[model samples]
Target: MEYNIDLQIDKQSLIETKSFLIKIGNKESNWLGDVSIHHQATDKFRLLEAVLLDHRLNVVRKIKAKDVYTKNADSRSTFFDDHLEDKFSLRHNQFPYYIKYSYRIIKRDFLFLAYWIPQYYSNVSTISSSLSLTRPMDYEIHLDSIGEFTYSSTRAAGLITEKWSIKQPKKIGKADFSPPATESLQQISIVPSDINYGVKGSHASWEDFGEWVANLNSGLDLLPEEEIATLKKKFGHIEDQDTLIKKLYHHLQDNTRYINVSLDIGGMKPHPAEYVLINKYGDCKALTIYMKALLNAFGIPSFYTLVESGSNPKSIRENFPSQQFDHVILCVPTKSDTIWLENTVSYLPYNYLGSFTQNRKALLVNKGGSQLVKTPALTHTDVHQTNTYHLTFEGDRLTGTLYSKLKGEDYEKIAYVETNLSSQEKKKYCHKYFNNQGFELIDLTIHQNSRSLPEVELTAQIDLPKHLRQVGPLRIISLPASTMPASEVFKDRTRPVRLMMPIDAHDKVIIDSSQNWTWKLPENFSLISEFGTYQITYELVNNSPVINRRISLGSRDIPIENTAELYTFLLEIETYESSAPIIPTH
Candidate 1:
């Protein structure tokens, strides 16, 4: 894959300047020519022309506007300045076809425009790519990359253009389990080095970057005088700062809904406090800004911060600071605690960063500049999940009530099930979530607790599998077969391992035969490794077979050297679990 960027810079009227990009590739390297171009009203990028030129640089056909599909892209709302997206398709849609296409765009200056290497899920070993830049030498620019990128300049027609190219061997694999920066595949981030947008002074350091953000986001505290006094009146009774924060947070949640409003500079700088207060909705940026404004109303200070947020935690490179964030939140300081609020989730609880932003670095803005701070880490107790089952065996069938509760990072999964699963689909989800090869959910109820912490409760009556064996009186049962939480054995033990999310939880299983039969127990089964511990305990109380299983995983990513130990421990658990069939003696 070859990507070329030709920029005609207009320092005075940046939007008036033109930038053309060309991409050409084929499937021999697993490179399919697919592109999506985005343009907004404030910095409208016009597409002059686009066509597929064969390997010989001959035009096969031009992409017509009619043939192209354009749709409005609202990261949040309709008010976000008429955003447009164009998707182009070439003559065919398979590999082994070589085509080159180019499109011209008019871009706003001083933005972090970039090309991510080895597009998500692309096998670098099967592909080779390069990046070329054609710009005036007068523009001092800095290009950010994790791996080696070549730099060279050529002079032609009194124009000195610099080019940087990165080529990888076919079938090159990437390891991305780092703490501060997740370097999955080397990417390129390009920006003008010594430039300032409005106030973001320079790209030289994180401090300069923060100052620039501070300038663009200046005056975000400007709210209506009447509104400020009224806002103060609302939380004035609460003397304690944390208590006041809880009240104000709940107030914000009840009054506003998340509607994304990202367009042009709106994508970065937020809307004023009054706009969101009147509209009662905003994206992460606008909402964070507005929350800070409300805090200001009560003489509480807060900072608008940027972070790369998602269910799977990601980190920003501490060494190389660039604009790579996708979401924004507010950091409010209290007398003894720092509250991290995710503005987009209107129903978020107080100081609950959820799994998306917890234990990750964020760029907090101040009048002086930017400071890098790590969000509060979620502990084992914080991310807790518990599952319990009460079972009674009658003849050849096993039926019981299953009660489950998930909180913190683990709760995200069950919450998804609650929202996405229909009444009819609940059984299927039960089977999947419980890892039961076969199970029937008699009835299921899901509860989403959104006030204090992110919690989900699932209560159901389930008929479990492996209940009847050989259709005989002396039957065997293995309790908590799939209740243990662990990853299916990882095959790539040689690769570096990084825990994407921490794993820690407890589970219990209780089986009763209605006092009809006595039970047999296996030798104590327990496996302790560096990863954590898994234990299964059993005892008989008045002809009732009581079973308890608990597993707590310490880290998300295990080191490569210890991957074998982790694998062996998990293998033993699976083996012992599968062999724990006990005989019921009547």
Candidate 2:
């Protein structure tokens, strides 16, 4: 069944106010299924209306009929839940669920222009069938007229049966556009009372913590004296628990290889420490728990810390424990440095935490109990690199040599790539890197130093087509590549753009020319032609020449129905050129 939806929003205030409206609908084949609409609300706000559109018969059902005041007190609303499964027909050719809500401030001065922001699925889902939006709706305040505003939008739709289509809303105006400085508007601090700390497994009492350690030792089948002596030495240093914990953590980190292969049952519980020792590889949880047990054997206090491994974005839940943590490490407090051990990575330098684990809240679980602590940040000195390259041009052929000095994570990335790739595969990879300039590489080579702060140097010889150069008199002459014409590429012929080559990060490129050529031609080549340098930088460099010769042309922006014209425009440009030769008449 086909459907059409129209949504509108309007707001008027004594001063300035921030307001928005959202409309969401879903189409499914079956009539009985769950529909979820979750949103956060606040006091002094209103949820104006929510209507369902029965497109087949063109009827609208008022599912929620309440004034703004009745719904203002609660900060959450569930329009539909499990109870509503039998109440509404959720099958095909039925009413489409639609929701539209707007809010305004009754008190305080609202100083900023309002916007309608849309968040599609974070990851694409294959179950959506259709998704689209007309121009996004937005209201902007003009600089000269502070109180006045402008608004515009059309309709948007998302439809699905078996697959999903996700389209995030486009920004209505310039993101950086803002009103002039105003002292009345203050930055708001939004702090939620509840943060998700993730789920907890079956707990062992504090007294059982030691027993758990003893069981782990026996289960690993470790040598009796080796285990006992190791435990005694670790426990013997009671004067400094922090140092003992750090030592145990370092031991675990040094011995373990961080491979993220999780068995179903092992994901929830730690792997046997003996298995980890034999395999030398385990996921974050396994390694972290193993470290904790080792610390316990030594009588040092340590804990397993669980947190998501990435930029620590704010959590959306109000009071739920965080269940989204993907990585685990260890935290031990010493008298000198509060040591945070990321046992998942074996190559990382001691006392160094990359940005992936920095400044995020993690749950620390130990016999002393679980609590939240923030991981430390990485400094500039921890991971830095310097790159340098030299290029020389012979005719249209270019040869270059590149060198990179890497530290920290940069070195690890290079080492991993080198170990995994074969010599021929590395050459193909270098070809793509040089192909960024639309050139073909003739030969490529890679060299590396296996010592401290590993470095990879790449050298390549490439061919830059001679047609890219320009010659001129009254009309500029250029030879574009067989793939495209200069006019089509430089569609906006009003200005010229500069060209730049991409080098590695922190790298410098020096171009050297072995020979220079200048030409003096006949009377036909002599004319009053103006020439100057052209330079503009967009996302990348666009430096191709322009010719003023007249040629037969086709329409611009061909319509979709004219498939032949579109194909001709795309394929015919390669064959376009002057068919006649230039001749001088006396």
The global C-alpha lDDT for each of the candidates, from Candidate 1 onward, is: 0.68, 0.39
Residue pairs in clash, model 1? 76-260, 125-170, 125-171, 125-172, 126-171, 200-212, 498-557, 499-556, 499-557
Candidate 1, residue 404: lDDT:
82
Candidate 2 lDDT at 215 equals 35
**Per-residue CA lDDT of candidate 2, range 199-307, in tens?**
2222123223222323332343232457557666755655576655645656776677766554432133456665576687676666766765676565555556667
**Model 1, runs deviating above 4 Å:** 6-35, 41-60, 74-82, 93-96, 116-128, 135-138, 155-159, 167-182, 198-200, 413-438, 447-450, 466-474, 481-489
Per-residue error (Å), model 2, residue 579? 33
lDDT of 1 by residue, 1-586 (tens): 4444555455533332222233334445433455566766555566666666655666767777787777776454456555677777664443334445555656554465455453333442323445555555676667767666677888776556665655552233444433333354566767777655555367788888888888888887678999978977776888888888878788888888777676546367678888889999887888888888888888888988888887555557676667868888889888897888877665446788877887778899887857898887677777777888788887677889888887775576666555556866766766675555466656777777656767778788788765557535577776655433454444455455666555666667777775577677887777787777888778877777777777766646566676777667777888887777867776
Best by TM-score: 1
TM-score of 1: 0.86
Summing lDDT over every window of 10 consecutive residues in candidate 2, give the lowest-scoring window. Answer: 532-541
